[model samples]
Target: MPALDLPFSLLDRSRTRAGEPDAVAVRATVERAHRAEGLGYSRFWVAEHHAVPGIASGSPAVLAAAVAARTHRIRVGSGGVMLPNHVPLVVAEQFAVLESLYPGRIDLGLGRSLGFSAPVREALRTARTDPEKFLRDVAEVRAYLQGRGPVTARPAVAQAPPMFVLASGAGLTLAARAGLPVVVGGPVLRGPAPLAPYRAAFDDGPAAPAHPYVIVSANVMVAATRGAAEELLLPDAWAMAASRATGAYPPLEEAAAVRRRSLTPKQRESVEQFYDQAIYGSPDEVVAELADLVRRTGADEVMLTTSTYDRDELARADAAIARLFTA
Candidate 1:
């Protein structure tokens, strides 16, 4: 078998499980980050979501700081921080504090998304929806990080931590033009249209590297058998389909309980589609598929985002995936 040579990282959304308190999910994420460090995973990133019951990580910088405090060596970051929800200076200071305390082990990945829904967006006081504002905000963030603006960000460091832009299509072009690395996944990874433009637009000047950096995010689960793997994936898949059919994104239920519930025809189709697209299998099968993903997408790194009902099984899957690169 070919070695799993591409770098791999963990992206934890801090998914809340059915019947468990949200606090448990948050704490579990930090614990998982510690485990990831010991398992030889490169980076552990937390995501931000608001007005969503299923996700507890509403503040990435705060969670990243918590993870950084617990782990000795693994890089901790936002998978990323949604820029529109935050004041640029505030975002700058929060990360500056993280960098001040943790030094070289922090990453700041920024995205232009307005929270999740219109109500959430309104609650966030998102003033700008224009795409051009995203560019402006990204520039402003870079400025604040480097203390280039009239008001210097507090606890100014000698350097800004490496920055990443999470985007696709035109967003990728914007990232490349700014010389920042772009993280791509979802629909963009499923097709070939977006990446070529990203590479073509890339200049790789002093602001970023000479070559483009691509990170692919995927829903991955691994178990001793294919059936077990599918079972592990079902809870999150069901929650997603439920969210689509009705706007409520509930916490994940147990696999057995989720399987017992009958889905609407539309929801059933959504669930099956999600199951079909996810990467899951025994160790050998997963390793082959993951390598092929890297080959097809030209990903510099692979970021695994797995949500499961069973904590023990989740840890086992994490360990199994880590071994592909380590063993």
Candidate 2:
């Protein structure tokens, strides 16, 4: 593959592995961030997930602070903070503090994901989320960060931190209108058609650059061989299938154990679909796929979310991917 032009970032969800405690998983995430910084990754972002046994990252802002404290250069941020889960001002304050501590090295990526489950939704004291409300909430959060409203976010600094919107196609348009950079992924990003509208409608704002900036996210895994990478990816695929089969998301299982079990037709289908969406293989192959993806979408940056059950393998994969873009 040709040398990559776009910068690379990592999105670590701190996926909990079988028999591994949440604290261990979170510690591993921070360690991974440190490694990514050493490997020359441009940024390291964490995700927010609640009440899911498989994901240890519950509060992105808190985790962001942790990672930021450990690393000096790489930018740290949320792959997203689900805006509907908390008040807009509180979110702003959390990120405001992050920026104050890190200074010019923090990002605030916001999304409109509803709670992972109905019970989780109730636990958060949030009702069923409305799409319209999510847009309004984004505006409110941005307002607080910019100190545009009468209210001042505590510990205010000279400027608000940069923000990236994680949204669907419609949400992309909203981000464009809001004049913020956007992080978009999935099938829509595989082709040029969907992102055209986002590129056309984007308006330069004070927070982000005048030109539109888009970060494309994907599930990527790289290893010495194609089969080896696929084997590493199987645990997460099976876990996703199990989540669909039994409404209970479990921790990542060992690759051997997951491969030994028999999956129902539906479970098999889910696993296959999840596997198909990801980019996995040798470094050359993975880089080639990412290059094509960037070419199709005109992405300014690529954010890779690599989740595997083995911490050692996960770190190795991170290194291999880093070599692809950073070499």
Candidate 2: stretches off by over 4 Å: 189-193, 205-208
Give the alpha carbon lDDT tens digit for every residue of 1-327 in model 1. 455886789999999998899999999999999999999899999998888989999999999999999998888999899887877888889999999999999999988877657788789998565667777777787788888966999879777877888887678888887778888777643545367778788877765667889888888888889888999999999998988965657898998998789888998998987876688998888888788778887788888998898898899999988988853
User: For model 2, what is the error of residue 21's alpha carbon versus the real structure, in angstroms, after optimal superposition?
Assistant: 1.3
TM-score of 2: 0.95
Report the C-alpha lDDT of model 2 over 32-78, residue by residue, as the tens digit. Answer: 99999999899899998888888889999999999998899999999
Model 2 weakest lDDT span, ten residues long = 187-196
Per-model CA lDDT versus the true structure = 0.85, 0.85
Please give the distance, in angstroms, between residue 128's alpha carbon in candidate 2 and its true position after superposition.
Answer: 2.5
The local lDDT score (0 to 100) that residue 100 gets in candidate 2 is 89
